[model samples]
Target: MLADVQKALDAFGEREINRVFFVGCGGSSSIMYASKYVMDRESTSLASDLYSSNEFIHRNPRQLGPESLVILCSHYGKTPETVEAASFAREKGALTVSLTFDPDAPLAKASEYVIIYEDGKQGGTFANEAPAIMLELVLGLLSSKEGNTKLDELLPSLENLRGIIDGEKAKSLAAAKAFAEAYQDDKVIYTMGSGANYGIAYWFSICLLMEMQWIHSHALHAGEYFHGPFEILDEQVPVIQLVGLDETRPLEERSLEFTQRYGKRIIVIDAKEFDLEGVAPSLRGYLAPLVMQAVLRQYAEELATARNHPLTTRRYMWKVAY
Candidate 1:
């Protein structure tokens, strides 16, 4: 899948492409947030933007044109708004690419370049695959433009990511079990993280807890917590902090310290605690969210089991027309 995406990217030529837009919905949109972060920090020549499907179609950016590349992601590829957004981009003469689990999905039909993955193969999480592919795509494009060998050197390490994630399954399962057991009775949960892991935090809060398990949850950035969210901290409220081994670790640490002092039920899922064997040290910061996604899948499953709620149970997601 990575090679295929790289090939599609190569066909565009570095100079021909002016901007890259990562557009999606829900968890898909959250992963694009991380992709935009990577492009902003690493890419020198290419510009990157992120937009939700509905917003992209209604409030389209003026920069979108024939020279622009729009990357649309949807696991099922059937999301009405995202499909409409892809059509809108195509109408504007922009190149459209889609990443989805189903190659024959509506999203794939709307795209010129499609990258498909087996549904259950990516550690039971769609969040893990898209970012890995998108990150490599951005890095590869930037490396070609800047002659940066570091990105080329780091690209191959992503192939070993699955093995690294599998090696930590036992540890992730244990942590999930403990977290589920402890937070089973909590009425509402608070999740926090910084940097790339912020997207994972948002995914857990919106996708897993609220949407799947029907539990009330809120996701907040560690840096933003002190501004307003910190006022909600108390001894009874449970907090889940995802700490990554990145430059933003200090921000999460500050939030952890303050949460620990006030909240009695603070659960920390720190990537520093895991042994991400075979992954390069220099790339750990970028891969931290992928690692957390693997761990959080286990946590989500365990939480569903502990609460006697199946993850498949939904009230309005697929049952009714929205």
Candidate 2:
């Protein structure tokens, strides 16, 4: 799949690509944030932006033309808005690439370059997931445009992601169970992180906690903790702080310091705790969020079990038209 991603980028040519747009919705939209963050930090000449599929179409940036690359994603590739976004991008003369599990999906048909990721329902490893694929695309762009060598070092680690993620998930189970036992009755859960991990916090808050578990939640940026959100903190509030190994570590640490003073029920999922045996030190920052995500999955699983509400339970998601 990485080879396919590279081939797509190579065919597009670095000289022809000046801007990038990532478009999706819900969890798909959340997962692309890390890539956009990486691109923003690493690429000097390239411009990148992320948007929900509908918004991408609605805003219709004037820069959406021949020199632009639009990457869209959908788990099953049938998301109506995402498919429409793909077609919209194509109509605007931008090179359109898409990541999806279904090759025959509407999104795939709508894209010019389609990368089919492994379906999680079919035992796909984290290496083959959307985030990993998108990260590789971002690395590919960096390598082609800015001469980044990190991708070469990161590829081997990405290959070993399955074992690393499994080990971390195993280590996280005890903590997840403990969290489930302690915070089961809490009505609203708060998630916080900075840099790349913010997307994981966002996904956990919306997709797992609120959407799946029927709990109210909000994702707070660690950098914005002191602005207004910290006023809501108290010993009774349940806050999950995701600390990643990125440049934004200090921001999370700062928030953690303040959070520890007032919030008694804080669950810290720090990436530093994971050994990440084979992963290179240079790539840890880029890969930490995926590790954090795997750990959060265990928390969601245990919490759903503790609440006796299966994660698959949904009231108005697929049942009613929004």
Candidate 3:
């Protein structure tokens, strides 16, 4: 399952490159952000660029050159918008790398490099998203010589998470089941995350919509909870918090309190359940989100199934046509 991804990492590690531009849409776009965040926290090996496929095709005007390598993220090479970006990247003379399940996928055919994730065949939304997360970790590890930086340090734990979540009867099912029931009636899903977990917020919403659910969900930066989003909270509304162990615990705690102030409950999913006051301040933030992401992913799926809905109503993320 991981064979192509492993090869992609080895290939990426050997590159003597300059600028790195990461381009993907929807779940695939998270890969670009994850890569940027991981590298920014540790080193300056390469200057990185992150762009959504639509933006890259319609709005972004940056130059793509031989000196720059574009990490093109798409689970299905058939996604027209991303495939267009893939074509554009090629025409611009930039080296392209892709992470996908099929080695011969149109997206893979469009890149100079390709990585495949064989976890399971059809996750729909989950399919492309998981590979992006997995490859980002692997690429982060291969980037350094010490191989002991924060990114490398967390790779094993992240890998373990992918394994656990891959199973149908994983331990996270129970928690996921419970959480889903709590918000079954919610009109919107507010996924909150801090520090590295920012990507998680997006990851969760993507899964809920793709895992055969029709929920309208959006991501919130953890500390940014103070924004007007707090304006629409009440007993009928719930704000699910992705509380991880990280340097930003104090900030997360403050947000937790703020959510409760709106008369809403704060559900913190971490390595283990604990009283909010007793959780660690400086925590192991890396792997905590993976476990919960898996748990909540299932909950999101169950909620949609109970309501008789398919992952998302739209054929794709066509948010607008005007």
Candidate 4:
């Protein structure tokens, strides 16, 4: 999967892409989400721009013209929603691309182009790690190409990031820190963010809810926090803010200060500059989330296990009304 992602990345070199839409169900959508986070300002993405196939007939009807390229992602080719989306796009004359672990699934046959992700493993539940890493690789390639970064030069740092993420000891340390902050006496977790980090906030809620601690969680925009979310803040319900070096730094800083002003506590993840309190500065953009994934994964798994839950499950998700 990693090498394939690298190949897709290597193949992307600002190849005159005007518009691309990414469609998927559940975590498969992360490809588009991560892509949008790393997307160049010069280009536009419809990646996170998802729509339910059943609803399309009434709301937000897709006008798929011949010139559009639609990227379809599904870990399992059987996801009815995604497959229907692909079929709809294809019938409307859009190009389709699919990335899936199962090469023989319906999605593989449905897509015009397919990238197989068989990591020498048999059937198992799809975790958050592999899909995120795989999508990141391809989008990183596409992004680097668009940003005009020498691919060879960026490869080393990207490799370094991969190494740190893959290393158990480093992941352990980061996870320990995140657990202390995430599961500290508070049962309520408030996720707030701005800019690209907003997606991280969204992803955090997903992991925390679905995989990790099954605690009550809510996510909101950092600026909007002052309007209403701030009222709910207290020591027992501390705010977990995503602060990265994106365009939202100044506002995040103000948000950090605002949290402290009300005696509302916070644990900053991926923010810049610490002159103020709760400003956890991480690397810029996608790199920040990559760097923080270790801790996030750790806290999520540990909390889930501590509550006697398995890290992966299939019982509930298979209720597909096919």
Candidate 5:
């Protein structure tokens, strides 16, 4: 998939792609946030924007133009809003690329280029595939212009990610059991993370806890915790902190310390505990969110099991018209 994405990027060689848009919905949109975070930290010239599928179709940013590269993601490749956004971008003459599990789905057909992965083949998480492919393509494209050596070094680490993630399943599942038991009775929960992990926190809160389990959850950036969110922290409120190995670790640490002081039920899932074997040390920080996502998939499953609620038991998602 990476090789195919590389070829697609290569085909855009001589064009002046001034901006890049990562457009999707829900978990897919969170994946875009991870890619945008990487692009902001690594790319010197290209500007990256993240937009939800419906928002992209409705607001249509002025920066999206003929010289823009728009990448969209949909797990089943049939998200209506995302497919429409792809068609809209293509109609506007922007290059459209899609990452999905189904190559023949609407999103893939609407895109000029598509990277398809077999869902559930690698543990049923797009977290590993989408982020890695998009990061590689974005960095690979930027490397040609910025000459960043980190891109070259970092690209190789992706080769061993599957093995490392697979190896951590036991540990992740164990942690998940503990987490699910702790919060099974709770009606609401709050989650916090900084930097790239913020998107992971958001994804887990909205997609898993809220949408799947029918629990109320809020995801807050660690840096913004003290401003207003901290007031809600109490002995009874459950707070889950996702700590990553990035520069923003200290921010999450601060939030963790405060949560520990004020909140009795504090669950900390630190990516630092995972040994990302064969992954480059320098790139681990950037890849921490993807690692955490893989780990949290175990948590989501355990939580659903403990609560006796199947993750697919949605009240309104697909049962009725929204």
Candidate 6:
């Protein structure tokens, strides 16, 4: 995967790249948020943005050109909008790189460079997962172009991620099961997080709770809670608050305190629960989302079982064309 990222970087060349755009849909789009966050915080000159694939096409930014790099993602490589966006980027003279689980997937074929990744089912290493690969790609760009030194700590943590994830999953099982039993009957659920872990909250709300389990769900940013979303808080709406060990921890902590005061049912999945023995202290923030996602997958599974609904069950996703 690193080799493929390097190939993309090489193709991009030393053209004084000024901007990056992350384009995708659904879960694919959610994973890009962390990469964008990393770029925003670390890079002084490079600008980064995230767009849904169709939006990327319709609102095509004028900055996209030979000096730009666009990264597109689709798990199966068949998402029409993302594939079209990749082609559109290439046509606009921006260097295009795509990530997918299939090398022969349409998204792969459409882009100039491709990086193949492993989903949870493949199970060899967390580094092969979409988030890790995307982080590496972004970190690679920052390291080479901006002289960012984060990768030194990040690479070692990624190497140990699979073990950390597995351990968290094992330890989180009982809490997940309890959450499922208590919240299975609720009509609506909410997820909230801040910083890098926000994407994990979004994925859980959209893909896992709502899409798979047929529950009404929404993802909330912890920082934005008091502004308006906190009004919706009550005993009935179960908010699954995801706490990351990042610099933004204070935001989540503040929201959690309010939720505890006003909300009756809350499930707090704090990344601090994981030991993270081998991961460096400085990189824990970036790794928190990945670890939380792995732990939350167990919760999602337990919720599905408690509701007597399989995670694979879907109503209109692939079955109906919009």
Give candidate 1's TM-score: 0.93
Please write out the lDDT profile of model 1 over residues 42-66, one tens digit for every residue: 7777888888899999888999999
Cα lDDT of model 3 by residue, 1-322, tens digit: 2455556556656765567777887766763554566555554456766788778878655756666667776776666777778778778777677766567788877777776654444533232345435545434544543354444434444434434455523655676667667766666667777775667678776655433465677777766667776666676565677676655656667777777676655566654452222212222454445545556667676776656665566654556552
- In candidate 6, clashing pairs total 0
- Distance from true position, residue 111, model 5, in Å? 0.9
- Give one digit per residue, the lDDT tens place, for model 6 in 89-200: 9998888889998999999999988998888686787777889988888888888788888877778789899998888888989999999999889889999999999889
Model 4, span 1-322: residue lDDT tens: 3555555554443233344666775556643554555544323443334443444423534555555556677777777767777777777766666678787888878876667764324523222234444445444544653553433333444445444444533535554555665564556777777766665676677655543555577767888777887787655666766676666667677787877676445766653321211112222454555445444556666656555666565345555444
Query: Which segments of model 3 are wrong by more than 4 Å?
Result: 1-3, 6-14, 61-63, 121-159, 162-172, 206-212, 272-284, 310-322
- Local accuracy of candidate 2 as per-residue lDDT tens digits, 1-322: 4566877768655448999999999899988989988997888899999999999999999899988899999988999999999999999889999999899999999999999887455654666778888888888788887788777887788888888888898888999999999998989999999898888999999999999999999999998889999999999999999999998999999999899988898999999999887888888888999889888999999999999999999999889998
Off by over 4 Å in 2: 1-3, 120-125
Order of the predicted models by TM-score, top scorer first: 6, 2, 5, 1, 3, 4
Compared with the true structure, model 2 gives a TM-score of 0.97
Q: Candidate 5: where are CA atoms >4 Å away?
A: 120-128
Backbone clash pairs in model 1 (N, Cα, C under 3 Å; residues 3+ apart or in different chains), count: 0
How well does each candidate superpose onto the true structure, as a TM-score? 0.93, 0.97, 0.77, 0.73, 0.95, 0.97
How does model 6 score by TM-score?
A: 0.97
Clashing pairs in 5: none
Residue 109 deviation, candidate 3, in Å? Answer: 1.0
Error of 3 at 45 (Å): 4.3
Each candidate structure's count of clashing pairs: 0, 0, 3, 4, 0, 0
Checking candidate 1 for backbone clashes, the offending pairs are: none
lDDT for residue 8 in candidate 5, whole number 0-100: 68
Clashes of 3: 3
Candidate order, lDDT descending: 2, 6, 5, 1, 3, 4
- At residue 314, candidate 3 shows an lDDT of 60
